[model samples]
Target: MNLVLMPMWLLSGSVFPASEAAGWMRVVIAINPLSWPTDALRGSVLGEPAGVFAWAGAAAF
Candidate 1:
């Protein structure tokens, strides 16, 4: 489940807590512990299908 989202700051200054509200979003990498780009798994093209967030598995389809 790859996500291609622009940085919240760019979309809306409210994304952050305190800022000038410039509203400049960018494509930032958002990864969970289970699926992240890590050096430990160098040279690997696979990742665990899970989320590291504590409440990530609250529900399932």
Candidate 2:
């Protein structure tokens, strides 16, 4: 499980800046279900703008 999920975590835009990540990495992050909640929490706590998609995705989840 660690082996399988570690890569997903790495590619989930959690460890690195999504904008600076490679194109493929960004694509992976975009589809990652974890990103929405992470983004929402980050936005709420940090007063950052979590995109509409993030809210919608989190709501959908």
Candidate 3:
């Protein structure tokens, strides 16, 4: 599962800010199931509140 999980992890905004990603890559990040949890954790660690969409995405997974 490394092949799948690795790419998902990379695309989940964990390696770089999602905002800096290309438009198409942002779309990919949005669809990645791992992005939500990664966002939530990042927000928590940074003391930034996660948006509603992040919570919703986390819940969805």
Candidate 4:
């Protein structure tokens, strides 16, 4: 599972902002399940409002 999950975590934008990713990479980031909670937590810590999609994605998992 590390093989699958590790890449997902790496693509989750936890290390870098998704905005800085290339177009195709951004698409990968968008589909990564981990990105949702990462984005939600990042937004909470940064005092930015998390998007509805972020919450929904997190809740889905």
Candidate 5:
């Protein structure tokens, strides 16, 4: 995404300073840690934290 942004910034007569750009990238990454296997979980019809609940169920029995 930053690669995409770079060309636009060059054309726009403006640029995010290097330090600010890196900080923006870090914020984007931090929003999605991916520490949990949340694939297709939040938007699925099940509409619950299925990954966590499924793990708990497997451990319970």
Candidate 6:
């Protein structure tokens, strides 16, 4: 599972949040399933803006 999720994790900006990454990387992270949950969780815990669209994307999947 870890191996299977590795690409998503790396692309999701978990190690280096989008803010510090390149524009292309941010674009990739935006579409990564891993990023959605990570962003949502961060938003909830930090009271920041959540990745609302992530729920829709998850639903689609």
Which candidate wins on TM-score?
4
lDDT winner between 1 and 3, please give it: 3
| Candidate 3 regions with alpha-carbon error over 4 angstroms | none
Which portions of model 6 show Cα errors greater than 4 Å? 1-4, 57-61
State the lDDT of candidate 2 residue by residue for 1-61, as single tens digits: 9987788778766687789988877888989887787788789989999999889888987
lDDT of 6 by residue, 1-61 (tens): 9887888878876688789988888888887877877776677779887765865654555
Colliding pairs, model 2 = none
The most accurate candidate by lDDT is 4
lDDT of 3 by residue, 1-61 (tens): 9989899999999999999999999999998989998898888889999888888888888
Q: After superposition, how far is residue 9 of candidate 3 from its true place, in Å?
A: 0.7
Candidate 1 Cα deviation (angstroms), residue 35: 28
TM-score of each predicted structure versus truth: 0.14, 0.74, 0.84, 0.92, 0.21, 0.72
Clashing pairs in 6: none
Separately for all candidates shown, the number of backbone clashes (residues 3 or more apart, or on different chains) is: 3, 0, 0, 0, 0, 0
What TM-score number comes out for model 6? 0.72
lDDT of each: 0.28, 0.82, 0.92, 0.93, 0.39, 0.76
Predicted structure 3, TM vs. truth: 0.84
* Per-residue lDDT over 1-61 for candidate 5, one digit per residue giving the tens place of the 0 to 100 score: 9886555434321233223446655454333323112323332545755465444433443
Candidates ranked, most accurate by lDDT first: 4, 3, 2, 6, 5, 1
User: Residue 16 of candidate 5: its Cα lDDT?
Assistant: 31
